[model samples]
Target: MDEGCDGTGLCIDTGDGEFMEISLHSRNSFERKKNPSQDSGFEDRGSKSKKKGLSVSDFLTRNLFSRKAKESEDDAEQGWKLFGRIPPKQAPDKDPQQITQEFQNKLRSVAQPKNSKKSDIEVMSTTALILENRPQNLPTKDPEEAEKHRQQYEAMVEAARKKELKELKMKKKQKQQQLKNEDKVVCAAKRWTDEILPNWETMKSQKKTRELWWHGIPTNVQGRVWQLAFGNDLNVTNELYEICCSRADDRIRMTIESSEIYGNSETSSEPPSSKESSVELIKLDVSRTFPQLCIFQKGGPYYDLLHSLLGAYACYRPDVGYVQGMSFIAAVLLLNMDVADAFVCFANLLNRPCQVAFFRVDEELMKVYFHTFEEFFDENMPGLYSHFKKHKVTPDLYITEWIFALFSKSLPLDIACRVWDVFCRDGEEFLFRTALGILKMYEDLLLHMDFCNLVQLLTKIPEDISGDTLFKHIDTIRMNIDKKRFNQVLAVNKES
Candidate 1:
């Protein structure tokens, strides 16, 4: 057993081998307090008792030796230091049971009341009412009032749900009716194919190989023959010739005169007719003829449906205005599908995100194709650029028509149809592949010739890239280029 002195000089017996020693100064101070010392050897006992009772020497010794004494002295010094030389009054000691009881009473004051007027069932119903109706002021104390409020709220919710369901049903029925009407229109438009005299397949296969002989017709008979053949017909072919003859404007006349001279002449010495002549003639006729043909002059259901669709498109896109290139694309479609179906294909092509961007008047979108080609040229044929620069041949002169018309004017009819078949299926990537094919076809000529000769060679390329050789080259290029990778490059260019 160990005896330990607490700060107040009370001895406690700790049942252990360890002994806690108290300082002599602490023991003396306690004795003096309990039973005053007879000797005045303790300096100024009256004032000392009044002033914390420990001398500077006793304070130092207690702090050094006794744990309990040191703690008490430290507390006292801290208190006086906080109070600026005057010691603070010590708090009186409280019983542990008394403190616990006081804390419990305070907790009870803040706690929610257990004896609520509402029953558990009523409380739950009232909570639902609060959620449903959400009244600003609620009667929490009376269960009957809360129950009545909850019943009213539930009735209101049921009414709202019924009304919403009714409205939803009405909208769904209306949408179904609209879809039925749209189906009727589509079916009516589709019926014209069955009603028409010749189906698209028969019309596509129709052969009219009438050849006009100007063989024995003298130079003087030429003008007369032209007037007789073209004069009576108000169709596109004659009207375009009439317009060409009437234009007398130097450039237009020269283009027409050159077309007639080279087109009709069998001479070996003269330069061959420019491909532009046939294109210009076709452009004139398409611009003039299609609008009148679309008037349904024959007055049949097939004509009406065909006219409506083609007319609507022509009216919608007046800038393009029924161009000759579209006629080729449309003619190909009209081979497999009825007019209405062909129109749908044409409309989808024009409206689709990939193709629509190419036909804008600003021509800004076509720059992507041009830029892609520039990259291709720089990478694959660096010498081509040097040659182009040397010859001062702008890409715009040749590529503009090639891309815009999809080479419809440049290629013969049969070849153009084959190219368009792939083009419609694959989208704009086919155009690049086709261009690469053209370049590769002429690679031998391109590599051997200088800039001036290159331009002349390319000018003759339209006639050269005519047959199975061209298709083979196009197929080879398509196989070589990863279209998905090219599309990704295009997407990135669009974002930038």
Candidate 2:
């Protein structure tokens, strides 16, 4: 709901304790920012989220972008480090040269679905009935008391009906507006599709693909862009992917044959081959992947595809085998690319020179990732870093999945995909940049939290958050990380 905390905690009551909160107000704060100096102080405002429990907005009330009273220069620098540079000043809208501009042209042709205006009809007279606790001694046998109870029940029912009707109308109105947004999205997607695919050779890297990606990739065209960002063609990548899949298929048959002939019965001399064991393990994590999304429902085609991709990768790179978080990354890739293409991308990611170490659980290279995260956070956001340190909230508690899954598991889908768009183009620093981005977005709130609340709060992806908002910081704050230092940190730690 809220964006960022302004480094000050506000006292709030929730969960049976008095806690201090220092987070941005929810979605409404975006509007508050439109008129930053509206003269309404803290008491007139509270969080705008309908989500139950104490929200992040109880304390973060300042408009990081308010014009009348802008944040101090230091705060502005910190905001940039956390979220990206402030948005450019709004240029006054000029009269369109033609009535049919791109966004307007896309929507101008679509008629609003019929009866959409009926949502505004008011059911204005439902009286809310308040029925407080009464003594048990009151006799229901009394006619007056019985009649009073009956009226109260009827009024309550009417009130509930009124509430549901109002909400339903609101949902319908929102859906209509969403359809309009969809048209604009389609128009924009068409432009991006033209840039990458049909004209790949011209726009591959000779253009500002990174800047374009940072803006946001149209979901439909994002996968093709990802391939181009990696400087590979679809044909070559698919070929390598298919080869890996064939090898894994062979391995699977061998594993099955060995199992059938050996008839383990706890008496076999050799244990199952690594590939066989990995298949069993992969099966376990397969179902756990994106259980919430319809596309990844258990026993579905997409789920099976995930099975195929992970199996291919494990067989393709025996040394790495399978890791706990690989399933998440593979699932997201499969959503955007063909199964074979997904496998190739997955393998390349694991085999990346610096990134490959992240798969080594609790090993030297893995430790390097954790160290690099700390160094980046310390360099960019020392105040938030010190607060995390003060509370003893270690990186192991949260950064593991972040490094390996690249926030696909914890952040909003669009946000996670945007991160991947950048990751494919920019390399490992993108991960660190996103890591810092998450912390920067939540630093003020985190400063006021204890360990349990801090970890829980940091791990959730609010359904309503916009990835474009999070990606803004990634573009503004350049995380110039050193790959060589990763090796240095590992070497020094090992010697110590």
Give lDDT tens digits, candidate 2, residues 1-496. 2332343223344443323343344333222121221223332245432212222322232333334334443343333323434567677776676544756766855755546556465454444554544678864457687688878888787878788787878887899999987886787688777665787767656557545656667888877776566553333466666777788788778767877987544333333334567877888888888887866657688977887788877766677788888888898888888887776667666666555766755476666567767876787788888988999988878877787787888887777887887787667767777877878776777888898898897777457766656766555654544644434544565566
Each model's lDDT comes to 0.48, 0.66
**What is candidate 2's TM-score against the reference?**
0.59
Number of clashes recorded per candidate: 0, 4
Candidate 2: stretches off by over 4 Å: 1-183, 201-209, 232-243, 260-273, 294-298, 460-464, 472-496
Candidate 1 runs further than 4 Å off: 1-283, 287-310, 318-324, 448-466, 478-484
Q: Compute each candidate's TM-score over C-alphas.
A: 0.36, 0.59
Deviation of model 1 at 263, angstroms: 36
Best by lDDT: 2
Of candidate 2, the 10-residue stretch with the lowest lDDT total is: 29-38
lDDT of 1 by residue, 254-300 (tens): 65576678875543332222223333544444443234334323343
Question: What's the CA RMSD for each of the models?
Answer: 32.1, 33.6
